[model samples]
Target: MAQLFTPLTLRGITLKNRIVISPMCQYSAEDGFTNDWHLVHLGSRAVGGAALILLEATAVSAEGRITPDDLGIWKDEHVPGLRRITDFLKAHGAVAGIQLAHAGRKASHSSPWKGGAVVPASEGGWTTVSPSAVPFTENEPAPHELTLAEIQQIIEDFRVATRLSLEAGFQVIELHGAHGYLLHEFFSPLSNRRTDQYGGSFENRVRLLLEVTEVTRAEWPTELPLIVRISATDWTEGGWTPAESVQLAKLLKDRGVDLIDCSTGGNVPAAQIPVGPGYQVQFAEQVKREASIPTGAVGLITDARQAEDIIASGQADVVLLARESLRDPYFPLHAAFELGVDVAWPPQYERAKPRRR
Candidate 1:
């Protein structure tokens, strides 16, 4: 069997293979409710035979949503809709997961198709908050600097979101500590310019994420897996670096984090990033080797052989697919055929399963 086809066990969850459907924002929800669109979008991947299906970045609160359409889990009423999706995923043999996120200074933006501009209070957008009163870009209005009390509230929000995920029947929770989101805002110095306990030194900059992890782990079931997706580098000078990612990975492992999903370059819009196939894989390799933790390699990983080599060479424990998965929901099934691995096809699709020559 190809190494990519082999099972990977994290905590009590044993994924049938190393292919994970990376969380990709759909921006297609109504007041934070999941509907048939989510069911079919995520369920198709599960039926296609990916071992783990992580839902998109789900907002933990209304104000945290990047757009009015982003899915949310802030209230108890959202559980049933989410549970419906999880039920479908598990039935199709995929472990259901969700990424809890907050947009912070990046909040109140129109969806990508809508020009990706900032939406103002007059336009149904609320005031955005962040670790500091900084805007993501100079053209955008400055967000309100979070007070100490507000910081505590954000922590509680994560705690509550964790419980809500459990109720929604998800087996994994990946905190959105990457992509210049709220948690990422707190950790990256370029975004975090606070003068208090949550900023300045390395220890201080990472405090919010650490605290959020501690609380989330406390609320999450002991047997389930918890993942943190982080941009391993800011791709700019004097910004968050690979060394800090390794350091952060070590700290997360100590707090019961199961994996570090290594991604890069979302904190700064002007930061130059060398994008290409497996470009960010080096960060995953570095974190796994230095921090001695399981890491998932993401970013432009598109084919079976490429993914196989990543796991075969021991560079990363798993491979996460975002755009490729979007392009091919059955990438896992196609990959199995390409690699000559006899992974089972769903009975409904058995007639369509390709035969090895």
Candidate 2:
């Protein structure tokens, strides 16, 4: 069997294969509610033969939403809607996971198709908050610096979200600590210029994410896996680096984090990132080697052989597909055929399975 087709066990959950559907924002919810769109979007990936399908960045609070349409798990009422999707995913033989996120200063922006601009209070957007009064860009309004009490509330929000995820029947929970979001804001020096306990020194800067991880791990069941997605580098001077990511991965491993989903360059707006095929895989390799923790390689991993090599070479434990998965929801099934690994297709589609010539 191709290494990508082999099962990967993390704690009590065993992925049928190494392919994971990276959380891609659909921006199709209302008032943080998952609707039919989420059901179909996630359900199709499960049907397509991926071992795990991580739902998009789900906000832990209304104000944490990257856009008004982003899915949320901040309230009890959101559980049933999410449960419906998880039920479908499991029935189709895929592990259901969600990325719990808080967008921080990046919140209140319009969806990408809607110009990706900030929506003002008059336009139904709320004030955004972050570790400091830093704005993501100079042209944007400065975010409200979070008070110590407000920080505590946000942490509580994550704890509550974890409980809600359990109720929603998810098997895995990934914290969105990357891509210039709230948690990322606290850890990246470029965005976190605070003198408080939550910033300044390396240990202080990582405090918020560490606290959130502690609370999330406390609320999340031990049997289930917990993952953290982090930008391994900011790709600019004085920004977060791969070294910090390795150090952070070790810390997360100690806190019961099962994997570090390695991604990069979302914390700095103008950081010159050299985007290309499997560009971010190097970070995953470094962290897995240095930190001795499982990692997921994401970013432009488009083809079967490319993904196969990632796992085969021991660079990452799993390969997460975003745009490629979007382009081909059934990428895993096609990949199995390409790699000559005979994986079972959904019985409903068994008649259409390709045969070896």
Q: Each candidate's TM vs. the true structure?
A: 0.99, 0.99
How many clashing pairs in candidate 2? Answer: 0
What TM-score does model 1 achieve against the real structure? 0.99
Instruction: Report the C-alpha lDDT of model 1 over 13-117, residue by residue, as the tens digit.
Output: 999999999999898998999999999999999998899999999999999999998999999999999999999999989999999999898988989998889
Put down candidate 2 lDDT per residue, 73-114, tens digits, no spaces. Answer: 999999999999999999999999999999999999999999
lDDT of 2 at 146: 96
Q: How accurate is candidate 1 locally (lDDT)?
A: 0.94
Worst 10 residues of 2 by lDDT: 265-274
Error of 2 at 137 (Å): 1.1
lDDT of each: 0.94, 0.96
Identify the candidate with maximal lDDT: 2
